[model samples]
Target: MAEPRHTRLRRRTLVGSAAWAVPVLVTANAVPAVASSMKTDLAVDVVDPPYDLDHWRPKDEVPVYRGPRGHRIAARGSLPPSIRITNVGRLTAVDPSGSVEIIIRDYGNDRASSAPGRLKAGTTNPSVMWTDTTNQSGAKYKYTCRGELRPGQSIDIPLRYFVNPPFLHAEFNVLVAAWVEDQQEGDYDDNSLRIGHVPWISVF
Candidate 1:
């Protein structure tokens, strides 16, 4: 049976519309999938230990000294440790304005307590103070960058502190960590660096 001219014209129009709608629907459904796959890659790398174990130990064998008030005083040791944090990922990491946080933990012998240290921020010649001592083992540290850590770039923070001589020869563990305060990234396993078994000597 022969269809009317207007009817045939309308049928062709509907067919063309349906053909164009298929790809549009398919693309619309795929958009969520693509967006879900998009993720922020944030990673950190600790470059190296700034000072050796000998740097913490006293150069001479003497460890104790008599104070002015007849009290036993332990020898003083200084640590100027440098910590480097590098972004080893593809995407850039960002934090809120003045919200990036860095933490350092020093696990030393029980006989001696390690004091909080001051930190200088930079990559080569760091001189700006950016850390505050929070406790015996931790500090609230800041990085020099304005809030963005780009891929393959690094920031160095130098720490200076004094430690009392231990009761005997003991080992100290230093751990450094950093992160963005309100970042949405879930994985933080790589944000910390551990340099264990740093030796401290106390000679009686």
Candidate 2:
């Protein structure tokens, strides 16, 4: 005898649902493995970014050191804003070979409407700053790190972020963030220690 029509329908539905669910389960299970692959022995991280300028423009112009051969590019290129970074890795960075770099972005405050790093209505308790690489204001803080950084060693990376039209007295939130793009980091987590300021002080 043929199976009842309703019973056949229910079996078919369950089979189809199980087939669809199998792929989701596999994808979910693979996430941990993929994340673990990103692990590396090299470790370094940002410590803090201090901003004392109020109603000042970050020095955007690239300047040169007055060397014997006229103005020459210093070993460490210069940009205005500087943030401190420390080597938190188990081993010191490879000398004269490995390098540490940092970039800077000013994602505006609670009022900001940008997609990646927009803050919620109120409070800055757990600030989540986003890095908008396409943003013109986003710039690499250049410095020549040419030596060994024993664990807990810190260096200030000079950075600069400027708005073309200018933000003379604008009020907004600022997230000064740095990221480890090389093998120095075990995980790809963008960390920041905000140097908090009054709402009006974030003006660029």
The alpha-carbon deviation from the true structure for residue 164 of candidate 2, after best TM-score superposition, in angstroms, is: 4.1
Worst 10 residues of 1 by lDDT: 5-14
- Cα displacement (angstroms), candidate 2, residue 91, comes to 2.9
What pairs collide in candidate 1?
none
TM-score for all predictions?
Answer: 0.40, 0.35
Looking at model 2, the pairs that clash are 42-184, 109-173
User: Measured by C-alpha RMSD in angstroms, how accurate is candidate 2?
Assistant: 20.2
* lDDT of candidate 1 over 5-77, digit per residue (tens): 1110111211112111111112336586754444334333443433335555322221223221223544332
Given candidate 1, what's the lDDT at residue 182? 26
Off by over 4 Å in 1: 1-39, 50-80, 94-129, 136-138, 161-184, 196-204
Which candidate has the top score in TM-score?
A: 1
Q: How does residue 49 of candidate 1 score in lDDT?
A: 38
Per-residue lDDT tens digits for candidate 2, residues 1-204, read: 321111101112111121111111213266766544532222223333232257333322332222222334222111323444455443444331122222222324343323212211111112222222233332233233555555445555443333321123223333444443335322333233332221221211
